[model samples]
Target: MRIKICGLTQLEDAQIAVKAGADALGFVFYPPSPRAITPEQAAKIIQQLPPFVMMVGLFVDPKPEWVTEVLKQVPLDLLQFHGDEPEAFCQSFGRPYIKALRMKPDFDPEQAAAGWPSARGFLLDAYTPGIPGGTGEVFDWQRFPASESPSWILAGGLTPTNVAQAIRITQPYAVDVSGGVESSRGIKCPTKIHAFIKAARS
Candidate 1:
């Protein structure tokens, strides 16, 4: 399974995750989030990264101008939209993007997946009222459809403890984690990162 360690704020943490076998590193750009980092800060971290690791920037419903400014400063490999952004808006950035679908009670994974034709993939995250993402709560894995289309990712509340079970059940194209491997909010623990990757790979 592909592993993406999200909410990375420190260069050391990013390096640790990369060393731990993470395929992608996510950096939050939403101002309200505690894990938010400036484009300049992200640029500094991205500069030191070794080859082949994908760098992802997470945005909520941001103005196009903001995204343009950030892209100018930080060379992000991909964009992940976590809010209610239209496909047109997502594609306007001229970059491959993933749309995050908050798993509400009535959420239909197949239907939602069909909606984003241009999306590289969809990230299925648990729905918490008033929270856009990073709730760190798992949704019903059984709710995922038996036949996957438009490749989907499993996120929210995953950790080394239950990731194996999650993989077995959902069989997602990728798995994403933020608080699961964290030492604290916005801080990643090296040991947790290593353990989480090892568990997911197994």
Candidate 2:
């Protein structure tokens, strides 16, 4: 499974994730998140990254102007929207994007995935009333559909300890983790990063 290590704030952490075999690295742009980083900060980190590593920017209900401005500054490979953004708004930027779905009790993964026909993929995150993502809590793995058509990414809470089971159960196209491999908020632990990647791939 493809692995994306999200919520990176430091150059060191970014490098560690890359070295540990992460396919993508995420930068949170929403100011409300403790893991958030400015576009400029993200740009600096992106510059030092080796080629072939996808850089993803996470935005939550951002103004179009803000997205435009960030794109001008950071050469992001993809955009991930974690808020209530309409299809038109997400497509306006002409970038391949992923939509995050907050899983609730009444949620249907396949039905939700069908709604975003234009999205590159769907990121399923656990729903916490006020939180957009990174709740560090795993949702019901059985809720994931067995068939993989549009490509689904498993997110929310995932750590080295249980990522293997999660991957086996969900069989997602990719898996995203933030706090799961963290030393603290916004800080990644290299040991955990390596372990998690190894577990997922194994």
Candidate 3:
């Protein structure tokens, strides 16, 4: 029942999520995402965080040099690959990373899990054109291959209203959310954050 609130831009919202007992905070580095935050900005937010709170950096198909440069600036606790990055590419950075799988109707989670052995976990999210993640859409929760996969993070369209049910069904290692608790595209709602976490933990 770990809670990760993604797409945090404002320090207040980030702090609020932390106060609300979020296990992790995700900062999108992918420019195309509305929730995207620059490395410098992300650093400012990260610097003020309390200990034991995980800071995750979300990246797409970034070049090796760019990823290295970003790490030099921001002390990210974990890396989340939300695009088409090979296992070698993700592992080359020498950091723990979570691989995101854009689940389609016919996607095989077992096969996807085999491709990313080094990953700390696998995040299952909805697939939509022109958006890497945070589509605020839910797929068939019952379709995930949890029996075969060791680690899985359920994402997409999860909120306080249905998160408990989702957790009951998926029993994921963690839950990564962005748009589900948003006030807008990237703005998080503190009330929503509290409710979501409470539901998950209950």
Candidate 4:
């Protein structure tokens, strides 16, 4: 399973994730999110990163024009939409983007996949009011349809302690984590990052 550590706020955290063998590093661009970082700030941190480390920029309900503006300033390998963006809206950027599904009691995995055909993958996260992600809440793993899942990233309240189990049960293409590896909101803990990656790979 691939590991993506999201909600990164510091350069050190980004480096730690990279050193810990993370496949991707996520940077939040949504203002309301506690982990949000500016393009200039992200650029500075990104400059320190070596080659082949994928960088993902997370947005929530952003204007198409503004999304382009941010992209121009920061070097991002992928885009992740965490709000009510339609398939056309996400594909309009001409970039591979992942759409987040706030997993609810009634969420249908097949229907969700059909709704966003253009997405490179789907990120399943727990539903929470006020906050789009980084809620540190896990959804019902049983709700995920075994035969209907697309290229997907399994998320939601996953920690170093439970990431291996999550990967074992879901067998997702990748696993995205934020608050689960944090010392606090928006702050990543290296120990957790190392442990999470080690557990997932084992």
| Clashing pairs counted in every model | 0, 0, 0, 0
RMSD of 3: 1.1
Give the per-residue lDDT digits (tens) of candidate 2, residues 3-109: 99999999999999999899999999999999999989999999999999999999999999999999999999999999999888999999999999989998997
Best by lDDT: 2
The true-versus-predicted C-alpha distance at residue 158 of model 3, in Å, is 0.7
Q: What ranking of all candidate models by lDDT puts the best one first?
A: 2, 1, 3, 4
TM-score of each: 0.98, 0.98, 0.97, 0.96
Best of the two (2, 4) by TM-score:
2
Question: All models: lDDT?
Answer: 0.93, 0.94, 0.90, 0.89
User: Candidate 2: which pairs clash?
Assistant: none
Candidate 4: clashing residue pairs, number:
0
**109 in model 3: Cα distance from truth in Å?**
0.9
- Over 41-102, each residue of candidate 1 has an lDDT whose tens digit, in order, gives 99999999999999999999999999999999999999999999999999998999999999
- Error at 106, model 4, angstroms: 1.4
Question: What tens digits encode model 3's per-residue C-alpha lDDT throughout 125-172?
Answer: 988876778888988999876673568899999999999999999888
Give the lowest summed-lDDT range of ten residues in model 3.
143-152
Q: Assess candidate 1 and give its TM-score to the true structure.
A: 0.98
